[model samples]
Target: MEEQRVRPGGPPAWWGHGPPWRDGADGEERRARWPWRSTVLLTAFVLAGSQIAARGQLDERAALDPFARVLLLIAAGQLLWRHRCPRAVAFGTAATVAVYLGAGYPYGPVLLTVAVACFNAIVAGHRRAAWAALGMLWAAHVLVAHRLYRWLPPSGDTAASWGQEAVTAAWVVAIVALAELARARREQWARERAERAQGARRRADEERLRIARELHDVLAHSLSVINVQAGVGLALLDTDPEQARTALTTIKGASKEALGEVRQVLDSLRTPGDAPRAPAPGLDRLPELVEAAADAGLAVRVEGTAPRLPPATDLAAFRIVQEALTNAVRHSGSRHARVRLTREAGALRLRIDDDGPAAGADAGGGGNGLAGMRERAAALGGTIEAGARPDGGFSVIAVLPLAPPHREEEDR
Candidate 1:
């Protein structure tokens, strides 16, 4: 997998939790607080507006009294708890407005309280409750305006016009429509937030796997050479001082090279999105692998030349050969290994073999070298096979595609 290119900044403020309004887990924004200041201001507006409206409807409706003021206050007060108890507040405000109108009080800002309540309920996912409340209030207003007005409060009240009823019905429909629109927008925002979070997690997992493969390939190959050289140096320390010094020198060179490669890998983490300072290792470095194996007492022969290839394919091919030879030095009894590279029309085939009689019981089931080799091949849309050869030898075979399976989309 390719390394991720992070943007030049820290993670987003809402990276883990999503936006502030969308912080709630189960639809409602539990962490977002409802404002009591708006509700308090609304109450003052409704009280003052009713008195002004009462003067215009003095001949048609009952005058606004202390009792009428109390009813308006009750309706507005219900909005304070609309977010916490949407269903209850929705029905409560609707019922209060119905009773005030039935008492022949002048029509005014009392209906605004019901609108606010229903808005909160619908946005909170209480659609049925909000719709039912508005329906009940409309039905009560119809009965009071058409039939009950004959026996109700104003001394000489007449039946209200159907025109007035049409206006009220239009207001109810508008509130419900507006609330439905808000609910849909809220749900859309939430879905987008969830998709972003899921994408982030998947990218993080892929990066972790890429880093693991890089570390295993570098450390395993270098450490295996060091181990073999250390064993040789110990055996020749007293018998052949000259050979012992050469073994020690090989160990130093191998360790230094390993440190440089490991540091390159670490640099990618610290400065993400920047091109690597040193070019990645590729098939051109096959000579280095051959010399390193010789230092560890293994003779590796190259059979075919590698052609110019894409960076990813070349890197994967090199790692596969390096890992296969490392496995031979650590597990195979034979000191000779042969690597044959075959460049086909669309793919590159690599085969590494060592004539062997198993070195130990855990020959094939050893460390992560083989697994890392297979992972590298698979990442390039390739395949790897490593096991005991039918002719009493161990072989690692890989087939890698020359081009990536698909063109990567450029970052937006």
Candidate 2:
């Protein structure tokens, strides 16, 4: 079986999540029924309006005979399929209107059917077809009204005035121009909707990445400390009861702190618009990282100080340092690491190094740690470099902008 993808804040595609234009014809067709209400109303209007028009022009045109009424019905009925087959309905209505006029029937709402069909066709993106259909109808009316009137029409009729033809031409231009306007407006609205959807998807992706990074940094650093302490506790459990108790105490503190941070991260998801309960961890929390590293048996020496910073930049800097130290604890052979912070004019530089021979092949946790660190830095228009130090050690350096770019904040 194949799995289907679902969008956040929207149903699956198969659930018909959007408009027919955005989704497809199948979904719209499924929801469609006979256009009975509209079609019936239009037909009645054309029939009744034609009767009054024919009575008024009783001497100039044919009476509203049964045949003339049928022609009007056919023209109006063509609108029933305007949405399903716009081009066909457009041409069909125009053709019917032309025939009704060729037989000298009184002009009434019959032309309205053709206008409505042409409008739907143009709005449905069949511009050329609708234009041609209306043009053909106009040309047919011209031929019958001018040259074929004597042979085709009831009794005796004269050629239509050039002024009337000009009026008809202008009407045709107006209809086409109006449809073009509607089509352009619809297109602009669709573009805006699509951009809004795209932005929503982008923001969703960024948020998911942020949560994952936060969880990784918090759990990885905490778990590394807990793992080391757990081992120490078990090793000295019987031989040195006091030392074992102290190790257990460290583990308890690390686990409790980890739970608090994890809960904070989860709280943001529960109430997205609410302010965080605790201030986000920043360089101000450096002592916590140092204390945690010491518990993990990795001696960490910190150098330099960072000025107060924006929440986003501060958080990124804090996470990068935490992840770097976590990696040092888990991968480096030596027990010592050094961290240096250099504040430049508009940036903060972090450099972390540990003497190493590399604990194992999977020492860097297969690159997720490094990738997460790099992502944190890059999100702030910064860069990160980590590799083996030619002199038997590993080093990670990151340069982060003090102020994040405007677009980056919008993305968040």
RMSD of 2: 4.8
Task: List the global CA lDDT of all models.
Answer: 0.85, 0.84
Across residues 1-412, which tens digit of lDDT does each residue of candidate 2 receive?
1111122224554232333222133535532765777889999999999988888998889888889988998999988888778889999999999999999999888888988899878877888899999999999999998999999878888999999999999989999999888666656545555567788998889899999999998999899989999999999999999999999999999999999999999999999989999999999999889988988888999999987789989999899889988988888887998999999879999998988878977544457789999998898899999888888788889999988877733312
Using TM-score, give the best candidate's number: 2
Candidate 1 lDDT over 1-412, as tens digits, reads: 1111111112564443333223254324442466578889999999999989999999888998899999999999988887677899999999999999999999999999999999878877789999999999999999988888889999788888999999999999999999888767666656665566677787787788888888888998999999999999999999999999999999999999999999999998999889998999999999999999999989999999988889999999999999888888888888899999998868999999988866877454375777888888888889998889887789888999988698474221
TM-score of 2: 0.90
Q: Residue 109 in candidate 1 has what lDDT?
A: 92
Q: How close to the true structure is residue 104 of candidate 1, measured as C-alpha lDDT?
A: 93
The parts of candidate 2 lying over 4 Å away from their true place are 1-31, 362-365, 408-412
Please identify model 1 stretches exceeding 4 Å from their true place.
Answer: 1-34, 364-367, 407-412
Residue 224 shift from truth in candidate 2, angstroms: 0.6
C-alpha positional error of residue 347 in candidate 2 after TM-score superposition, expressed in Å? 0.5
The per-prediction tally of clashing pairs is 0, 0
